[model samples]
Structures are given as structure tokens and as C-alpha cells.
Target: MAETSRGIGGLAFDASKRARPPELNVLIALIAIVAAFELLGRLLIGDSFLFNTRDNVDGIFNQQRLEIIILQVSIVGIIAIGVTQVIISGGIDLSSGSVVGATAMISMSFAQVALVNGQPNPKGVFLEQGWVDLPVIVPVLVGLACGLVAGLINGALVAYTKIPPFIATLGMMVTARGVARWWSKGQPISFPTESFAAIGKGLMPVVIFVTLAVLFMVILRYTRYGKYCYAIGSNEQAARISGINVEHHKILVYSIAGVLAAVAALVLSSKNLTAQAGMGVMYELDAIAMAVIGGTSLSGGRGSIVGTMLGALIFGVIISGFTFLRIDAYYQEMIKGVIIVAAVVLDVYRQRVRSRG
Candidate 1:
């Protein structure tokens, strides 16, 4: 190999290339997309899509729409943070969405208030039973425990049993969703304590998402765990030869992913004031999509939390833009699918270039 070329931990990288950084590229694409929407808005509705200089009163950024875009993606962005790590380790996790479903149901069952109207609660899933209203911490702990256990199971299966990541997580996905459905016998869990409800009220989800992203960004960029993940994804055989306990590292990574999913569930349930068996349907895919669009290589070994954040922003903007344009729900889904496929194709191409470089 030429001196100008070196491996990224283990994957290939060419310093000679002048290509724009992945995150920057995605940012540009997001701007282009927003501009397209704005143009369409002007042509179709004879009104501004993102600005309102017509009155010279509203802010130029369409403050309400900006808030909507950020808030809409924050819950799922938390999940994407975890998913980004998993994919960076060259592993796939299909169980996260289901983990959210399961965690939500289990935690809410504990968090439910025993009283309504200053009386024994009716519609109380736990009040009529021996399980009375527990403190908010109890439910939060329960949720975290549920997520940790589920993640540990995934790690064990993949690390010890040597099962393929896809198959293992897929099995978990089905099982966890089943658990969610069975938790309250198909009933929705609601009426959480005031403390619990406050966890994700209003702008709280965005706060939690941003804080976690910053924390993990630091960890991923500055920690041994980050290096180990890149090493494993880049080349497992070489990582093992270099004294990395590949199995333990994998378990740790998966466990982290699980806990993050649980946190997302907590925030989501708190925001909605309820938890349902179907709460997180297709969420795993959305999280994965964010990672991919953010320039996380699907083949693994290369990604960034910043890129995923931008990807999430793009996701929020696109979805909200579609709604702003009055696009139908079904059509929106189709377009999203196309975008995901395109992202994967682009990733594959990037991998090929790196391999050749």
C-alpha cells in the first residue's frame, strides 16, 4: 500500500482524496432538500414554506416548524445514537424497537398511580392488584433493568453461541414484542406518577437526546471502548490477535444499546402519558435509517455520532416537509423506503472505494 494510504483502525482510508467529509456532505444534502421544499411551496401554494417575510413579522426560520422538526426526531434520535454504535461495531440490532415496547409496558405497570379522583383508581392496571403505586424511580429502574437484561441476552447469544447478529436480534425482536403484548394482556398502561410524566414533557425529549448525544460523542471519540469497537468492526481476527476481548466488548456494546433503547422508551411513554404494546413499531428501522443516512457505513468500522445527529435532523426535516406539502402518509413511507435503499447503495460504494484506495 502507498504511504498516502492507511487503514482506519483496520478498514482502508486514503489521505490523498479530497472528498468532503461525510457529515458535511449530509449537511449539504439537508440544505438542498429544505430548499427544494421551499421552492415547491412557492410554486404550489403561492406561499413561503420555511419563511414568512410577506408580513415581515414572523421569523425567517419558521420557528414553529423548526421546533417541530427537532422535536419530532428527538425520541427516535436517541435510539439512533445506540444504533449508530451497534452498526459501527459491525453488528446489527433489530430488537431495539421491540425492547422499547417491552420496557414501556413493564415500567409503566410499576409507575402507575394508585389513585384517581382521590379514590382507588379505576382503569388502574396495578392498583386493584397487590402492586400499589410505586415511586417514579422504581419504574425507571425497572425499565433500565428490562433493557439491560434484553441487551445482555443479545450479547450472550452473539458472543457465546456465535449466532449471526441478524438472526439473533430478529428472534429477540419477535420475543420482546410478544412480551410487550402479553405484559398487560394487550391493554395500554397509563396514568404514571407526576414525577414520571415530567421526564419527557414539552422540550424534555430534545434535551435528553442532545445530552445523550454529547455524552456518547465524547465517549466514542475519546474512550478505549470506541477504539475497541472500531477495531472489532474493522477486523475481528486481527482484534483478537491484538488482545482485544472481542466477546466481552461485544456484550458491552449490545448492553449499551439496550439501555439506550430503554431510555428512549421511558421518554416516549412519558411524553405520550401511556405505553402500548405497539408503541415502538418500525422504530428500529427508523433508527437504522438515521445512522445510514448520516454516513455510517453499514459494513461497519466507520461512523460518527455527529453524522448520525445530522442524519436525524435530515430525517425530521424531510418527514415534516412532506407533511407540510400535504403528501399522503403512504406516499411518505414509500419515499422513505427509497431513501433508505439509496443510502445503503451509497454505503456499499463507499466501502468499495475504501477497499480499492
Candidate 2:
């Protein structure tokens, strides 16, 4: 009996000292993914995944491909950062994609230039000329307000009415999409003023995403708001009893998420120079997938902006690598689905192991 107790005590001691930061594991996975693509590129495409063997470029790396990878994912990466926070706070948001679509349409209308080549702008949404060529802030504030209202409604429903987050967000998703289509009668909104266009030019989206990520990383790690989020997510009853305003925090979290979605809309619309009702389709799913793959637990109380950023990179790398290998788009979708499920399964397994220990 004494030996048995000693053995158990030793195991516990070992387990206590074995604690590892989850981000390290995610970083390792990212490196492994990059290496895999490198190997496959050489074998299947006779080209490199990240390196440039061509003599035209002085650098050893494929700079253009690298830029494309970052640019392509930067917009969605913004949404992922918000999704990471929401998940950590034990809530789900299914309306961010729709919010992007709606905000884009509405904002673009106010951003229209008065004339195109010295003629009345053909794509103007407003019949009155006064609505055209307005200040860029007009559209920006209007767009953000749309997101804020939608988020407030979502938060109120989830926090006060006790509606399930999935149902609440799903309802907002449909409503926001309807609003998007209605905003322009299913027509695309195009042509913004020069000031508005600058918002997403070149690498601006990447800069915006990285800036937000770093800012939020600090917020989540150091602020009382961050502590409340983790606490509420880990155990709402316990947090409430401990004096954390769970309901209020929930509202704030959803509100922030909504604003982030709007930010993404602004960047996306500016980048494309147009806003279609179909814009941002399936973006919410992709954002959630990025967060999950970055090691965020869907069960809540655990996630990070940094992890989501890395996940976005992983997502971009995989897609770019597949295209470089000339893989079918259908196959690419299937593989992406597999990766999402695998990540979720791994998270569940980790949770179970932790519980058992």
C-alpha cells in the first residue's frame, strides 16, 4: 500500500512539472505544415513551396507568393481574432460573415464618388447628389454603427433572454444577410472615394490585422476584462459569485466581435473596390476554423489572438501550397474540412486527458 501511494505521488509530481504552453505546440504544428508542403512541392510539382529556384529573383524565397498568402488571409484573419475572443468567453458568433456583407453594402453607398470621368456615377445607390462624395468617416461611422446595433441585439438576447448563443447568432446571421441584400436590392455597390480606397490598399489589411492581434493579445493577458472573460467562460456561476459581471461582459464581448466584423468588411470592400450581397460567404466558418486550428478550445476558457494569427498563416499556407501543386478545388475543400474536424477532435482528446489527470 505504501509503495502504491508513492508511485501515485511520483506520477502526480511528474505531471505537475510537465506543463507546457499550448502555443508551443501550435508553433510546432505550423512548422510541420510548412515542411510538409515543401517536401510535397519538390516531389509532386518539381517546384518549391516557399523557395524560389528561378534566377529572375535575387532572393531565395518566393516573395510574390508569400505576399499573396498574407494578403489573401489578412481580411479573414481580422475576423478570426474576434472569434478567438468570443470562443474564449464561452460564446459562439455565427453572424460575423453576414455582418461583413451588410456593413460593406451600406458603407459603400455613402462612399460613392459624385462623378465618374466627369459624368454622374452610374453605380450610385442614392438618387440625390448630396449623398455622394461624402467624407470617408461618414461611411465608416455608419458601417460601425450597423455592426454595433447587430451585436447589441445578439448580446442582449444571449445574456438577458437566456437564448442559446448558437440560436441567437444564427438568427442574426439570417437577418444580417437579408439586410445586406435589401440595402442594395441585390445589386453590387462599387466605386469609393480616394480616401476610403486607401483603407485597404497594398499591405494595409495585413498591418491592420497584426496591429489588432497584438493589441488584443495584451488586453487578454493583462486586463481585468480578460480575466473576467476567462473566469466566466470557465464557470459562469463561479464568476458571478465572485463578483464578475458575467452578463455585462458577455454583451461587451459580442459587441467587440461585431465591431471587428465591421472592420473586416471595410477592409474587404476597399480591397475589392466593390461590395456584393454575396460577399463574405462562408467567412464565419473559416474564421472559426482558424481559431480552432490555432489551439483554441471550443469548450471555452482557452484561446489567444496570437494562436489565431498563426492559424490564419497555416490556413493560407495550406491553400497556397495546394494550388501550387495544382490540386483540384473540390479536393482542397475536402482536405480543409478534414483538417477542421481533426483539430476539434484533438482538442476534445486534450480536454479529456486533462480532466483525467
TM-scores across all candidates? Answer: 0.93, 0.95
**In order, what lDDT does every prediction score?**
0.90, 0.90
Q: What number of clashing residue pairs does each candidate have, in the order they appear? A: 0, 0
- Model 2 bad stretches (over 4 Å): 1-12, 15-18
Please, what are the lDDT tens digits per residue for candidate 2 over residues 1-357?
A: 646545464643354645587777888998899899999989987889889889978798999899988888999999998888889989999999999999999999999998889988888998484799889999999889988888888888999999899999999999999999998899998889998999999999999998999999999999998898888878888999998888889999999889999999999998889999998989999999999999898989988888898899989998888889899989989999999999999999998888887
Give every collision pair in model 2: none
- Candidate 1 C-alpha error for residue 245, in Å: 0.6
